[model samples]
Target: MELGLEVAEGPAPYTVLAVKGEVDVYTAPRLREKLVELVSQGKHQIIVDLEGVDFLDSTGLGVLVGGLKRLRSNDGDLSLVCTQSRILKVFEITGLTKVFSIYDSVDGATAS
Candidate 1:
């Protein structure tokens, strides 16, 4: 499956990255590059909306961790909008649920 990425403005102090499709090894690089580009543009507080994502592998998780680290290094943060059980399980099993500020909706993440 392919990975679709869209960049948009979020609530104050945040930028939203709407993601669709699968995020596997082949497509992970695209997501990583976009995150890097956003951080380079000083968009450090990011909200990755994974509502449209159907699948996510370890490589995808790594990309997110990398992005989070990058943002934190810049005194910013990376949050996630993901409610799917399968995807949430990935974060949970990886112990990343505690690391990332994940919410059910964009509004939820923005409020935090």
Candidate 2:
């Protein structure tokens, strides 16, 4: 299935992007576009909830890292909410677990 992306305003300074479905090379660009749109709108503090994402590939990781870099350059941060062990393992194995502020829930990510 195709990727599903949803943007929502959270608390001050935090914009939440709820993503579902597979995020592969073909769909990574869509994710990138959403992130770029958010950054362009000056909504940098982002929480990408990947709880619904069933699959994630290297291109997906690249888009996420790119988004994090863009946000950091603007003095903002990009956090992640991913409870699925499969998805978490991707970050862990790639050593990106150290690069992102990962949380168990959206509330936890937004609070911090």
Candidate 3:
């Protein structure tokens, strides 16, 4: 699994959570917990960089949606930086491409 994360300061308070490997039913919850913990710690705005993620299942998508709602409840937002067409398709098929802010790169996500 290439899943990893690197958090840095951005224009507005933000976190770049880089996701690698496969995001399936088993790993989705772990990722969700990580995001939830960050939100709980006051890290509201986040950019999930999925360049390294080769695959993502419905469960993974659910985790992201759940996180988005959780953050929004606290006046926060979640954005995604994904390059893979396959992963993007999942978001599109699920109509989540419209639900979450999508970007092409981490720089774009953080800069936007």
Instruction: Supply every candidate's count of residue pairs whose N, Cα or C atoms clash at under 3 angstroms.
Output: 0, 0, 0
Which is superior by lDDT, 1 or 3?
1
* Superposition error at 73 for model 2 (Å): 0.4
Rank by lDDT (best first): 2, 1, 3
Writing each residue's lDDT as its tens digit, candidate 3 over 1-112 gives 6455556656668887878788988788788888988898899998888888888998989899999999899998999998788888998888887899999987888777
lDDT of 2 by residue, 45-112 (tens): 99999999999999999999999999999999999999899999999999999999999998999877
Model 2: weakest 10-residue lDDT segment is 103-112
lDDT of each candidate versus the true structure: 0.95, 0.95, 0.85
CA lDDT of 66 in candidate 2? 100
Q: Summarize candidate 1's per-residue lDDT along 28-48 as a digit string, tens digits.
A: 999999999999999989999
Per-residue lDDT, model 3, residue 31, is: 89
TM-score of 1: 0.98
Query: Model 1, residue 100: what's the lDDT?
Result: 92
Q: How close is every model to the real structure, measured as TM-score?
A: 0.98, 0.98, 0.91
